[model samples]
Target: MGYVKLEIRCPKNVAIVTSADPDPVWTLDDLLSELNSLELQHGARISVSSPPKKSKMKEMANGSNKPFVMRITDDDVYESESEDESTDQRLITGTRFAFPDDYFSESDEFDDEMHEKSTPSRLMQKKSIEEGALFELESDHQLMVKEQLRSKLSSLELSQKIESENSSFAMRRLEKQAEARQELDRRLDKQYQRKIAEILDNHLSILQRNHEQRSQIEERRIRDDATLEEAKRKEKALIDEKLRQEKSKAEAEVRLNAIKQAEAQKAAQEAEIRAAKEAAEKQAARITETAVFDASKKDLTEPKGVENTRTSGNIKQGDFVTKQLGIRVIASKAALEAESNRLAIYDEVAGRINVIDQKVIDKHGRQMYKYIKQIGGTVENVRAKAHVLVQLIKDPMLPLSISLLVFANKVVSLCENPSGSFDKSAFACGWVIVLIASQVPDVMDLVLAEFHRSCIYTVPKHLQASDAASQTKDYWKMLGYREEDGKIESTNEFLNRVESCMKLYAALIQTEIVGVKNPYGLNYGWAWLAMFLNALPANRTTAVALEAFLKMAGFSLLRKYKSQFMKVLNVISRRFLPSLKQRGEAVHDIVMKLEQYLDDKIYLREPEGRQLQASSLSKFFE
Candidate 1:
């Protein structure tokens, strides 16, 4: 007897069947019963195929039986195969069986049974089989079904294990790849951070170096500035010391000269007195001798009583005449001595002034203006020279120099012909006058008078004609009054030049004495103020020319020397009121403006107000 191997296929699993004994061949009934039992256990239907009859069979006597093999395929594939002998032979040799068409229809029931079998109670119930008559009959059937179920379960377990293992391997592979990517990203990020830090450090170092360099430069600049300031301070101290020494030496010399002059004057006075006495004695002797001769002759011829009366009358008349002659002689001698002393003082003062003038010329030379132009016309150098000139002028011990007068004359000349050029020398001269007036105010009158004579009233003779055309033509030909076009300048042009000089002089006076304590009283600028007022109505432009001069002078007087304000105001008001009335609105406006300025600046009490009220100019304000 030969044994057979049978394979049964289902949707989820394949079942293999083999007979336990070789002598018992599996019949159709046995096969059907086994299939039915398998369907019940696994909850799926299965199909079986019959083997073909052979022509001859020889049973070999062997200790082990040879088994026939059978295989199962899908029913859909089996139905598609063509029916032929080769196919039948292949099917028989292959021992394959096809599942029924209802295999999938039973799959749901099969899953239910599998779920039921997984429960522990159902598995225990299935394991406990009872031994009885029915049990004996179904024992073989149950045994076959159990074998087929075991094969199906084993096949399912094998496939599930293979799938689980493959899934675990793929999951592990993906995890490794993710870890590698993370490590690479972390390394790259660290490298980038390090690079950025290096770059930042390099930039910080550069900035620090630049900051240090700038600080050093600033420190050097500060040091240089301090050095320069220290140098300037030392230089200024030296200059001030030198000026003080010079002033002291000059004062000493002046005092000594004054003492000598006084001594000489006293000696001269005594000599004059002695000569007058001797002359009177000689005249008296002559008179006495003549009288004696006459009386001797008269004594021989005339009576004693008559001669005595005649001698007494003659003596009385001669005594009266001699007394008058002696008095006249004394008066003449004193006058001569005074004149001689005056002449000597004048000569000495003139000589001292000439020496100062020579010093000035040597210090500045004719190229002073050239030097002024060289430094871009900045007045710093000019101002320094002006300060020196002012110091010279303010030297009280120095005589009123003719050189000052000469320089002033030259300045006035330049001012009158400015020709649209800045005259630094003229400015310096004006400052000199201001210093002189402030220090030794007695010179103010003289300077003002001279300025009025030489510059203000000294118009060109040709320009003085009554005929306007002739005046204009001659004005063009004059050296100091000509215009750029070779034609006569307008009145305004001429006035402009005069006004500029006046303004310069006014500025000098105003600026130089701003904080000075004027011991000379506020009468300092009175001459200039009076002169300007007197000339106010000389011509149309004269008012304009004097306008700045008047304002500055008035303000200076009102502010600096308020004590003399009323006196100055009275004098100006008296001189200006008549002219203000005649000159119409222009002059009136100018006067009114000045008046308003004064009124605004000055606060007066009843007495002062009353003084102002009494003035004729006060009426215009009213």
Candidate 2:
């Protein structure tokens, strides 16, 4: 709800004034942009009455790169008016004729008696066309007015055609000149590179040949005999190493399997009598207890009543009970407060880790991710790169596990503003987290909590409608509103961020690096999908998040769950899409894409770039 009146000075200083909504003055930029398409010989110059916004105005300015705020003076306005009047008068020489039926003559005999001279009486009779009047001219120009107009129009069209062709010819000549210059530069550079490459190759080959010849001359027979034995020895050592790693991995899996079995049995025992939700809660608690290593560090116990420090003779039972209950109430409140503090600590840690200076990330983060991404593809290369990355960012004071998770935290933080190489290296970051979490399960919990804080749907939780004053702007911030300079982002931009976070989370679940299974794998993904669809209302934002998640994780889920995945898709089509339809154009396109993704069976084809190039892991996802 605002207004913007714009005064534009086109070429020849023709001043045009217009108004626009100022509530969102952003439209002013767009309105100015539209002026570029107008046929102004010199581009339109905008003149604003208000003080200039140096930042935005400079950005919106044309080639001169500053505000071209033309001052509209009386002289310029008067000249523009005179220019328009002259053009009008030149065109007024034409005979203004009306159809015979529409025209009504005031006095038809006046024209017969009238000589070839104009009189006020005759002029008064000829009113405008709207009054059903016609002009009876005394000048000879009326006889050939049609011919004159037709010739003028033809001449104008021919001149315009010639000008257009001349402009195009000039443009083509300039383009050819530029292309020729670029081609010459490219050929010169190519020749220089080729010569340098040839010189280096020849020098390296000569040195290598001479060294081989020397070695062969000194130990020809011995070297040839030992080569096979050396190969066998190295192969044996590699096999033993791989076996040891496999054995340790198997042991960890067995331990996890036993814990899962105990929970499964517990769930089965309570299935008939206990509420399914209660069982689920119990199961989740048990899994968290088993999986979260940091749980031991965060031992926050409620305070309990101590034995009577100084026992008096005899205490009333009711009084003692009342005192204990009050103590418990205070303790419970303290515990809840402590829990909120703990969550804040998690947020603080995540923020701190992700906010590592840009220079540090560029120096170490990308390299760390690169080594982790194609880890086993080339063992020697990965080893060397990972070592370099560790040296670059290593904290000798921290424990190995702590250092690894902290490193992973740094990598995840890059997703917050993926303006650099961080996005290209995201796959590696996902793998880094999964691999770290495989040994230190607290790592996964920390990452999930951070993502949940950023994007609520990763937790598959929706904000419930509430009238409480506490659930104001603070509530939206808690649900991860993106804020910059104390201003919240627009709806579309916020959703874009939500979608990015969802994609990262999806990548986390879809990962299967080396033999370390994704700790929170497709089962968790299945759970998220069910909970999201069941609880979250379908809207444009909902569709955006869901579409992003599916794009990253869908093919894998389809491969693993088959018909079950299809059924969930069916639910989305039947239940989710109709609600999304009412949300506007934003949702409409995504919903159509979602439908096409489902009906076209696009998930049957695995998404490209998802497949990592580990020796055996390459085809595992397929």
Candidate 3:
């Protein structure tokens, strides 16, 4: 038999069996059995076609029938072959097998030949060949199916992998965006914080500056208030002092007027008594003359008879009477003349005292007129006027001196008006008054007292202490001290002038004027010395001059006014020491030397007694 090919279809796989022999035949049952075996081996259900119909088999033998083909049906039987087998043949023939003509032939002879060749050995070989072909076909089909499945699965896996990658990339991009937003927010927050901090710092600095400015303003206000209060106090004090001085002056003037009035009354009474005495003497003389005349007439008429005796007696008596009467008349005349002369002398003396008083009044009026006229006068004019007044005070004529003193007193009174307007002219006038006092020793007490009163009420010039050193040097130079030599050029002359001034002040202090306290409230001598020292430079040379003056004046003052001298020492310690200490070592050393001298002269004599005094003085240095 030629090779035969049979195709069987299953649900999952298609199988084809081929035989090498022509006219190969097998029973339908046997074909079913082989198919079942393939199904079991391949793990699938297979089906075979039934044998062809007799007529159909004859037609196929005649080459007029279709090829045998089969497909598994739901009933486990193959589908019948169709007449249009060209497409099915191409599908089966891809396994490289050809269909036999007698494979589906129904001839009895073909059946017998198949039966004869279908012995066990031949069947076994055929079965083996069929199984091998089927296996080869099945394996080829499986490989093709596997290749298609692998390609489909690979495509699906590639698509899934791409989707997964896209999802992961999207998630990563979102995460990065979130991180970027967070970083941006953090940076913005930091910038906002920095701005806030800067604002706060600027506000704090502004507040600090404002606070400092306010504090400074407050301090300045406090200082201004303090200054105003001090000025008010000083003004009040000056007012009170001025009133007191005016009252004192008024009282002194009243007392002086009272004394003058009493002296005038006494002089008037004395003059009246002299007039009455002179009249009584004149009347007595007249009565005595009349009596003598009557006695002479009676004696002449009495008688011629006893004329001899009477005449002799009467003549003698008349002669005696006449002599007595004449003597009495002469005595009365001489007494009357003496009384007239005495009254004339009294009148002249009273006239001279009146004239002196009038002269003083006139001088005062003139001086007052000059002062009023020179109210705004130049310093030179004031100085000249003061010089004239000084000369007038030095005049040997008592009346001129008294008049100048009265004028001086008036000048002092004018200077003492603290409430009055102060001008340069007024200061110049005051200087003049001080100079007049310095020149006139006799009026030193009155002048110095007036000077003190004026100074007490008057405000000092506004001199800065900063210029004190230069001013002091200039003062020394003016006093004829040589700056290069650091000494007084005319020591003796300087000493003499200083001594004279000290003596004048000393005499003022010593004069015991009743009810008149020293206007400076200290020993006039010491007050003058302090005043001089205050005006001069607090330097060694000034101190030396002060020392000389003190040595000259201090002992006398101490002996006469011990308590006052003690007060002077206190003032010196309190006032001079502090200023001297500020000046330099030269001034300070001079002061120390003076203090040492005082200690040696005064305190050492009775250390126990003067302990408090020494302790008080020592406090200045401490």
- Taking all chains together, each candidate's TM-score versus the true structure is 0.34, 0.40, 0.21
> What lDDT tens digits, residue by residue, belong to model 3 across residues 399-421?
43344445645655442222222
Q: Give model 1's TM-score versus the native structure.
A: 0.34
Clashing pairs in 1: 70-95, 71-95, 71-96, 71-97, 72-97
**Runs of candidate 3 exceeding 4 Å displacement:** 1-126, 152-168, 197-220, 233-622
Tens digits of per-residue lDDT for model 2, 482-597: 66787655565667677777877887788776677777888878766765564445655667789888887889998898888878887777767766664445457788988888
lDDT ranking from best candidate downward? 2, 3, 1
lDDT of each: 0.43, 0.52, 0.44
Query: In model 2, which regions exceed 4 Å deviation?
Result: 1-394, 399-405, 418-425, 439-441, 467-471, 614-622
Model 3 vs. true fold: TM:
0.21
Deviation in Å, model 3, residue 209 alpha carbon:
6.4
lDDT by residue (399-503, candidate 1, tens digit) is 334434433444444556454433333334444455445555444434443444333422201112222223234323331344566545554565566666665
Count of clashes, each model = 5, 3, 4
Q: Rank the candidates by TM-score, best first.
A: 2, 1, 3
Indicate the residue-level lDDT of 500 in model 3. 36
